[model samples]
Target: MAQSTRRRFLLAGAAAAGALVVGWGALPPRQRLNTAVPLALDGGAVALNGWVALAADNTVTVVVPRAEMGQGVHTALPMLVAEELDMPLARVRIAAAPPDKIYANIAAIRDALPFHPDDTGNTQAFARWTLAKVARELGISLTGGSTSVKDAWLPMREAGAAARGMLVAAAARAWGVAPDGIRTADGELFHDASGRRATYGSFAAAAASENPGDAILKEPHAFRLIGRAVPRRDARTRVDGTARFGIDARPEGMVYAALRMAPALGATIAGTNAAGVLRLPGVLSVIDISNAFSWRLAGHDGAPAGVAVVARTFWQAKTAAEAHAIRWDAGPHAELSSDGIHDDLRAALDGTEHHVYFAQGDVADAQAHGRTIDAEYSAPFLAHAAMEPVNCTAQVADGKVRLWLSTQAPSIAIGIAAAVAGVDREQVELHEHLLGGGFGRRLEGDMVAQAVAIARECRGLPVQMIWTREQDLRHDAYRPAAVARLAATLDAAGTIKSWDFIGAGGALTDHFLRRNLGLPGAGPDKTTVEGAYDMQYAIPHQRIAHAAVASAVPLGNWRSVGHSFNAFFKESFIDEVAHAAGKDPVAFRRAMLLGHPRHVAVLDAAVRAAGTPPAGRAHGVALHHSFGAIVAQVAEVSVHDGAIRVHRVVCAIDCGLAVNPGHVAQQMESAVAFGLTAALEGAITVAGGAVQQSNFGDYPVLRMGQVPHVDTVIVLSGEPPEGVGEPGVPPVAPAVANAVFRLTGQRLRSLPLRLA
Candidate 1:
């Protein structure tokens, strides 16, 4: 087809979509909001609910509900299913799951409810149940919080095991033998007594009808694939460029889009001059993607007001966008700067209102009896800065909408797109692609909504919008800048008598709702004080509280979220108290963790792995438990001419039954690289309600030369598997800071530890 003819075809499709939207607006309001339904599978394959699908060719396909962003989840989850079926990883195929309640992430939501990890009271139980109910009903399918494996651990295994049992039962019926006498191996059912063997493919029809008793999952000792270092399913495809990432989604008659948004957070477009931009090469149309009415109702940040320039290619769109002129409303937040944010948080620490998440004996009485040591700490806001800049593809035609993107929360994305496009939720179809990298940024539905909003203007055309790196960095739901005040009372013998911790920051409640569901919620957010309040150290008289301050900075989950910086504040303060009382930091922490053997074990392993830093090098130690995993990190550092160089990090983790020990070690290494970058140079400052840094030039990651050698030790345990992706992140920054303090004698309480 010629270019002109193709353009006309796309224009006609766009017009059809526009007409559908107009028709949709005439329908009753009740019709626009439809209840979400479960998955209805297509194709000739046998659909076993939502997590497993089988073909007659003995191709066992396990449906993964998690997004693969280079964390090895694509392989880790497959192990759970393949292990139960007693099949090699090579024999099974992996597929993306449809958005359904059967795939909802039930664990993370339960963990998010406001309660200490140790809480078991009625209030806690009630909150947990309420959260669980909401998750199950809404089908809250997401892939973050290091929960993919844990959530899939039991269910995936059972699904596969049950299918395996049915195959054996079918073979037994056909061969006139007891089901117990039929053994299955490598996708085949066999009976040794009768010397009868048949491929699982031959029994597929009967197996689907056979009733297998309750699936008894394999024990650890009998496991063939769960614990081994199996290669990732996506490894070969990734290396050979065969993997289809979000950026690779190219729809027919697709036109590219490049966006220029309001520079300030929570700002809107006042006007634009698009005449000259349209004259540029390949520029198709200039469309205003910002929906002021819906943006206000959605209450989501990082959906900054923007104008999109659709063109023949991304480069054409991007080049034309750079020249487009626009006036932005900086709004009431024009004066909100980073320095002011910190000062306000610091001041709020002294305010009367504080919600304590954890408490023990009377902290006031303990402080009155013992000598107290106090310290203040702060951390700058951080950006997700994922490798793939925010992008989405959408096609709206004939009263229906289609979306293809790399997203963590597809259920939320489906609703967000349909609502934004003025279509019914049931009319939306979402095709999830592999994420280039998420790091918690993709958890929000902003990009999905933004794309649909733009696509609606395309008449019935298919549009793919790819944000520039600057656009991505400048408009992100940042990690909230925080301030912390910590105090410890020491007895005569240098024993810790009391602990008081007050953390003040931008609240996570509103952002949690917006990012999770494009809605709003009330009550205290557990994420606000997650790392600060949930430490397992056995301080006798302790009080941990969070002071919610006011800030309009767009805040969302970054890497470890609260733990990303709170670990620096809490663990570094503990080191200060240890030093103030003339005690060794490691031994001081050891004394406090008497009953916590799991925590103690990781700490001891980290210490042994690190041994001792030489006289020229200083060591810092930190232990943190998160996502039901305990990680201990020891950093060896040397400071010379006021520059700190981290030489090595010895990390020990007990994530319970390491699914793949090699992958666990790899994740730890990745986390150290991620955390060290933040510890050394990560910061996102706001000035005049706009972000200060735009790209890697200013907000740099740890380069290869700067990255330290990470020695990883995975502790074997009997408990169920926990999170490996995020648990390793919390302890790294503090370990580096403690090491710096030991070397320089300057207690660095703040993040991106600077020396004087």
Candidate 2:
């Protein structure tokens, strides 16, 4: 009788689980066409949907939901709306979308799932589908992962088409003509049969009442503004010094604040000379901001404790804060050092069994039958080092909080600010500004919370909190330092038979989810093993794994995240394997890429563009696929004065249907410069549980004189647009390292290649 009851319970549980899956899958997709709050309209404009507005002057305004961080997202996204709306790019203006879940970055979160890009199994598909729905409901508005274009591609176009349909229908009703007969072009509706023409503005008000039918999107051939090299919308403002970054935001009667966190990571303030600081010129108040918000993680608090000095002016605040004496009770990780962290990473390789991210075929059998090659590579923790230091302006008054800041994730920022200000989420009003540079740093909402925490003590006065460059670098949630062990077997035919890679690092995704979402991250993280496991090279037997080493140090996303360093590890190892098999690097890569025509095409384009290097320089090639795009780079390099000199770079990308070809080329140049900095000079060392590099004087970027001449070739394709911002970064380090090997006859296995 007990067995029968148990069996009945088991069957009931299975039936309920099956029913839940079916019901969840059958749910409709979240609406992306409306917001809880109406869009702000000017000049008697009418919002057609969540993404578009039409004015009485025939002006079209596109709602750009993503942050503008010099990535050309403002220009690129508007081009999508302008193309589908048949409006001239110049006439279309862009406005920041209000806080809304419709604009959430679903792609970025979906990409965070553990499924490999190459995995097309039913389980992977179901998991992705489920996660996407959940992410939509959760509504994480973010701008990292190069997902701005990819996420907005369909939605923006559909929004434009739907708006146009409404306008056409309005015009058709006004003229008593069929909506199909009324043709739209250049922001005007024309009835060719009756020779009647009307501006879109004439029907803008009436169109608000029309029922917008299913939008018929234009084909690729019909695009006019999307593929063209339109001028960046923010360029003129930035050039004319009219563009307002977070630091430039000046609310009326706003005071300034200077923040100083604990010297050690996650440490707390024990005491401060608060009376002395208040006596300084223009000093208003010194607030204790330790544990300002409940930024909790499992076994750790993600929030850093600090103190803020609020004063009449920024310089006054800065001076007072600098002179204010303080003492800290060092955190639990006081013994932490860069060397110790690296030792832990290396030890993890032997002491712990890593979670396998990807595996196929029998790697053990293939390795046992073939000649083996092994190598290890590592990358140090890196800071974003954006030109503009972290800053946020906040005011707490009338039971509400107002914020003016540059943040990559405003939805997250609003909630954090509300909590810090002791208000509801709906009471927070955010005014997003242009970012001088983001690179992924602004994704964290700590600055917003810190600003609100300081503002709460200002008695309703606005306060602009700014972290000096030293504070910015020292307190950054850094790119996790990683160490990778790679092994492969070469067959008698000089071809790779099997490849295996194991990387150890603080799990970036796990840390990100914990810090941002307050959720415990478990299972294998794809970010830890992406570039190694997701490579396009068709090796038969392969395995990719990650050993997540927990540390007290805070970790966050950098420019390309894992792909930035993993490509260096994976591609440099491939180059080494090619050398061991006595084959040219480019030829070996091509031989391995038999099944991936897209990768092969991009590689060939880069090689063709590179042609032959000048005298005293040698060419080295690297191909990497990331963020749904494939990029290949060929570096023309030579060694001089014990330094690796990369004279030129030829890059090719399959970014798929460029929204703005000129902007795409610009990103490649930007990535090369950024990646070159990391490969040549970037390092963040820690000692006594504190970051050693404080400012650009020590943590320098690549100088303009040292920047390589970059030539970009776009691989024309009909595929949908993928990421254009970060994919170019992954290949640069490996390409330069490989070139150094050929030019100097020495394998520089590590970053910041120094010759002995």
Candidate 3:
């Protein structure tokens, strides 16, 4: 059976079984407004559901459930509420929401369903609906996948609307007038007939008594604060250095700890000189925590075991930890190398077994007649390389665990911490801080778990564990390396008649589910073949497959997940097919996107904005759709002394309606710089089962001078808002690679696109 058909059948079977237990599974999501504990109100603050709090001073606070990782989510999420409540954006304050089922990332999971963006058939729609309900029940509160804005679009607005209606109703009751007669603007409710005006704060007590029944959201045209660019709410704090990142956490009695992990991916300590390490100045004790977490027992992989030195200061702890001598058991993977992993992927591709992700029409028959073009592309494993190294602070007292850290998934972090601390989830208190960078590094709970284990030996004192930059990179859950073989056939008319893309790599989703949820990952993973299978191009005969190869390397989601590398594969191959057919790259893509107006619009916008490349530079274009957003990028490139330099990148995005156009543009620019770093120099190599590149010297990032001047054009869209954070990243590498091909006539099929 075709993959799509098989997926539908499985979903149907699961839905049938779920309905028997979950009462038909068609119920709406669980209530998002009510919390077990009410919002901690003070100074005449009125709690309105789980999201909004109104104070007697007429201040509005919107609870942002997502992390503020420089994406301006602290500002953009509040805009959703301010627009509905008729409040000025500048007057709104932001608060991080406590971990709850209400803040679960239903959109992320629903978006992860193995269906093409254009596949809106009944089966896919039903599967999405069912998955969303299940996601709500699971309540995995996460803040990755560019899901913040898209997930909050409806709920936050409704919270504001409900509060607005309640305030209006409260005023109507006070004045003996109909609720419909009250108008709200700038935090004031007005009644023209009676000439009565009052602040929403004045009616806070009464509004709490009034019921807002099915409050209506404002139409797009009625939006006041949304669709307008406002300064980020946390900008001032960040600028003045008042913003507290995880590293900035300083508790009253906190000590410092430095970890010296095993020198290999799955190694453990055999022996250590604890007494000598403890003799170092300011060194409190050496705690051997190698047995704290068992990857096999936890169904996890590549969680490094280590010994930590607790001391008076971070530097002292680091000095002591590094000086300690230890013998390690490197295990079976001691001889693993990057070359070995590459060969493993190639061997997997040679196998006959594969999971077909998407298939349409008869690709074999179509491929038999047309002119064919085949290419193989590979991208090396990459580290998240977040600016902040891994660190976490934890304290265990009175059978309770308290943590201070930056995490992408608080619910998951809490769960991991609870387990490590041997406490119940509710007994754990997580204080989330701002992240210096999370591209996806903070998503894993390993850091939190390790910190909790270290703190357990601190005798009721809080311990802040910090990893050196070398340790951070070496022990990172690297992005999975992937290899793809793509073959496409063009008809006599220079139009693609058949397209096939088969990829092989470690399946990140399986690894993630096993490590995080302990759920067995069966069936085809959408992430393994996402960017290739979900292409918006209208290929009549197409097949996309993926063969998962087992690996000991710790894998995690990167900036764009599968789209990160797959776009480089699919789009670059598309460029090859275009050239082979003697057609312009943009024209070739445009021809395939006739049925996709949003894609065509973005491509046209990017092309128009890019215009003609300056002398000595060539422009290359690529388009990709991910996270319900379509982004097209045109890169201007020049090779100077055999070094590829991206001069400028013009990006156009149709991310539904951008919640904040300015922030959207900033994200595009950030994504381009990040993607360029990977395209030009990012790679995480392994030797003897350990990461070979430890710090920036071996693993370099894109320098400021190397960053291209990015121009973003957001196509005016009326569709519901989608994500902007990751959508811009997918097309960047391919765009640059294609531009280099255009300039140098060299097809760089491998990543870090070295010029030969």
How far out, in Å, is residue 517 in model 2?
2.8
Q: Per model, how many backbone clashes are there? A: 5, 0, 0
**Model 3 Cα shift for residue 720 (angstroms):** 0.5
TM-score of each: 0.93, 0.96, 0.98
Give residue 221's lDDT in candidate 2 (0 to 100). 91
Question: Residue-wise lDDT of candidate 2 within 330-392, one digit each (tens)?
Answer: 978798999999999999988766877667778899999999999999999999999999999
Q: Model 1, 357: alpha-carbon shift in Å?
A: 1.2
Where does model 2 exceed 4 Å of error?
A: 1-21
Better of 1 and 2 by lDDT: 2
Q: How should the candidates be ordered by TM-score, best one leading?
A: 3, 2, 1
lDDT of 2 at 587: 93
Residue pairs in collision within model 3: none
Tens-place lDDT digits, model 1, residues 204-273: 7777777656888888999988889877778899899999988899888888989988888777888889
